[model samples]
Target: MAFRPAQYAALLLGALTLSACARSPAENPQERSVIQNEDPFVAAMDEATNAAAAADRSARKTPSKPQQSDAPRVDTTAPKLSPAELRQRILRLTAGLQSAADTEAERVSRFLGVSFTPELMSIREGESIGDLEQVGSYRVSVSRIDRTAPGKHVRISFGPAGFSTGRPSICTFELAEFADALRSQGYDAGEVHLPHREQWGFVRYVSASDLTFYVSAELYRANDGTRSGKLCLADVTADAVKGRQ
Candidate 1:
């Protein structure tokens, strides 16, 4: 408290001189470490750490062999078929089915109660089929045993009548495609309009042949291009075709 400013400055210089005189030992090149502390355990840990780092940096990596998997990776993704492409395949399939049913009589015989693509179309005795025209996807299948008929073996023996099962199917065909498919087998389904079916699902493809197809396989661009198509294969007897409707 009684020290002068000049005396305080001299005391500070003396303390600094004493501190400078107390020198640290000259460091050994091998003992040099990043840690500058006096704690031997800490200094040893620092040396160990530096040694480990240097060893890690200089170590030759074995390039770890990619862990062998039981199964090799494969890209199983398949390209999706477009509507037009799908229509072509369906046409080919229809043609194949037609070829299977070789004779005209066979086509006429199996016309009412048979389907090529059974998943998209099939039937049994007394099983109801949906009529999209009359009841908005309402189905009324061929009665293999109809009590109303004389023999109870057929449904309709008259005008243009066929089957409809507009069940959502992966396989689909355009009106023209189906027409062309049928046409390939001598049946000529008349001009197919763009919007093949009416609002009530009534298709206007009328052909004068033993078997005619009125299938609504149009792709609705509004949705995911899913085709709820109606396949109507009519058997027009000579009497029915010759203005007998």
Candidate 2:
């Protein structure tokens, strides 16, 4: 029997629709498992996770301790100068004074009636260098001379002098000016110098040696540049000189 063309077309369309309907809506469990386990993308993802964990571990590593710096230590020892040692220093200093006087005998004779001598001078312990007070005013003090000079040019202690309460402003005056000022104030004064940061000045006073006088002064420059002068007055004697009177 001969088939009709319209019936054949309808029959093919129906078959195509049926075939599409019959197709599975879900994938096979075994096949999907194989794809997930075997795919390079999955393997690469696992490798990336492991690499991240390793990097985290590396970042969490403990740091090393810092090294300590090397620096110099400061010295804090007080100087040791005993009575004997100080006496020796005084002897040496007096000898220098005698030599200086001998070198300028004529000048010494004119300025001071007597020359320098060793037996006429000595150093005694008076007080430690510290603060000073005078006329109800406080000052930083160093040392005090209990004796007097033996000649015109004397070796005076320069290491010990104290600062006045009114510091720097009063201290900046020239040594000569200071000496002049002290003299004006009725204090025996002389040439002044900074022997060792401590202010020291030379003073001249009447001596027992008949028409002779000794010269020595000790002064201190305060941190503020102010100065304090201490004059030592003595009478020059031929055999034994009178100490500070």
- Candidate of highest TM-score: 1
Candidate 1 stretches greater than 4 Å from native: 1-125, 128-140, 143-171, 191-245
Model 1 whole-model lDDT (C-alpha atoms): 0.31
lDDT tens readout by residue for model 2, 1-245: 22233432332344335435432222777765576587767556657878999988886795756769765532222123432333233333322332323313343222322222222123311111211122111111111122232332223232322332323322322345434544553344333333243323222223333222223333434354224443221111111123333
Point out the worst 10-residue segment of candidate 2 by lDDT. 135-144
Off by over 4 Å in 2: 1-200, 205-208, 211-245
Candidate-wise lDDT, in order: 0.31, 0.32
Query: TM-score of each candidate?
Result: 0.22, 0.20
Model 1 worst lDDT window (10 residues): 236-245
